[model samples]
Target: MSSAMTNERLARLYDRIEIQELLYRYARGVDRKDWDAVRAVYHPDAFDDHGNYKGDIDGFIASLQQRHAHIEQSMHVIANCIIEFDTPDSALVESYFITYQRVLPSAGDARANYFLREPLADDEAVQGQAIGRYADRVTRRDGVWRIEKRAVIYEVYRGMPTIPGGRLRDNWTISSRDGRDPLELLRIELGLGEAR
Candidate 1:
C-alpha cells in the first residue's frame, strides 16, 4: 500500500480508539462523579438530548449531579460501539450502555451501608439498572475529537435484587463516588491528572 493510504488507515484506527475511549471515560466520569472528566468528553458548543435533559453541557451535568445526589453508588458499562465516519473530520457513533445504581433513601443515611444479614427492602433503598444507547455526532476539531451532539435513547430499566453475600464482600476494597476512590488515588499518585 502507498504511504498515504497506510497513514490514512492508521489515522482512522486512532480516531476509532479515541472515540471509544470517550465512551468509557463518560462511564467512569459519571460513575465516579468526576465532573471534570465528564465535561472533557464534549465540545464546548455541544448539545445533548438526554431524555429528561435536552440542552447544553452545563445543564446536562447539573441534571446528572442532582439526579445522582441521593445514590449510594453507581456503575456504568458501555459496550457495542459503532463509529461511522461521515467526513474526514466527523463521525456518527452509537454505543450501548447499562448502568446499575444503589439508591439511598436519603443522602448520608446510615442504612446505606450493606447489611449482609438482611435483604434490602424497596422502601429502604432502590437498586436498579437502566439500559440505553447513546447516539452521538462526534467531530475532530483542531486535531482533537469530541462529541458535537448526542441523543440518549432509553431501552429498558429494571431493579437489581439484593443478594446475600459472605465475608468475601465484607473484605472487598471500597470505591468512593468522589476523588477518594481507590483507583482515583492510584491514578493521582501516578501523576495522571486530578481525575481519570
Candidate 2:
C-alpha cells in the first residue's frame, strides 16, 4: 500500500481504539460513581435513552445518581464493543454490558441485620444483574471522539436474594468510588501518574 493509504488505515485503527476506551471509561465511571468521568464520555449536548430513563446527558447522570444511591455496591462490565465508521467524522457503535448491583435492605428488613442467621425471604436484600447493549452514535469533534447519542437495550434482568455470608471479608483489598484506588499508588510508583 502507498504511504498515504497506510497512514489512513493507521488513523482509523487509532480511532477505533479511542472509541473503545471511551466505552470502557463510561463503565468505569458508572461503577466508581465518578460523575465527572461519566459526563466526559459524551458530547456536551448528548442524548441518552437508558430504558428506565430517557433524557439529555445531564438528566441521565442525575437519574443514575439517584438510582445508585440506594445500592450498596454496583459494577458495570462492558464487552463486545464494535464500531463501524459511516464517515470520516461519524460512526455507529455497540457495546454489550452486564451490570451487577447489591441493593441496600429497606429499614426494618430482617436482611439488614447481618447478625440474624434467619433464612432470607424472597423480598429481602437482593442482588440484581442486567444484561444489556448500548447502541451509540459517535462523532469526532476537534479530533476527539465522543458519544453523541446512546440508547440502552436490556436483554435480561435477574434479581435474587443475597446469598448468606456472601459479603467480602476484610482480607480483600478494596476499590474506592472516589478515584483513589490502590492501583493509583502503583501508577504513581511506576511513572504512570502523569498519563492520567
- For each candidate in the order shown, give its overall lDDT on alpha carbons: 0.82, 0.80
Worst 10 residues of 2 by lDDT: 107-116
Best by the lDDT measure: 1
Q: What is candidate 1's lDDT per residue for 1-196, written digit by digit as tens?
A: 9999999999899999999998899889999998888999999999999887899999999988987787667899999999999999999999999988776656334333323324555456656778999999999999989999999999987764342221136578987886799988888889985754
Clashes of each: 0, 0
**Native-to-model Cα distance after best TM-score fit, residue 106 in candidate 1, in Å:** 1.1
Report the alpha-carbon TM-score of model 1 versus the true structure: 0.86
Residue range with the least summed lDDT across 10 consecutive positions in model 1: 159-168
Cα deviation of 166, candidate 1, in Å: 13
In model 2, which runs have C-alpha deviations exceeding 4 angstroms?
106-123, 163-166, 178-180, 184-196
Candidate 1: lDDT over CA atoms?
0.82
True-structure lDDT of candidate 2: 0.80
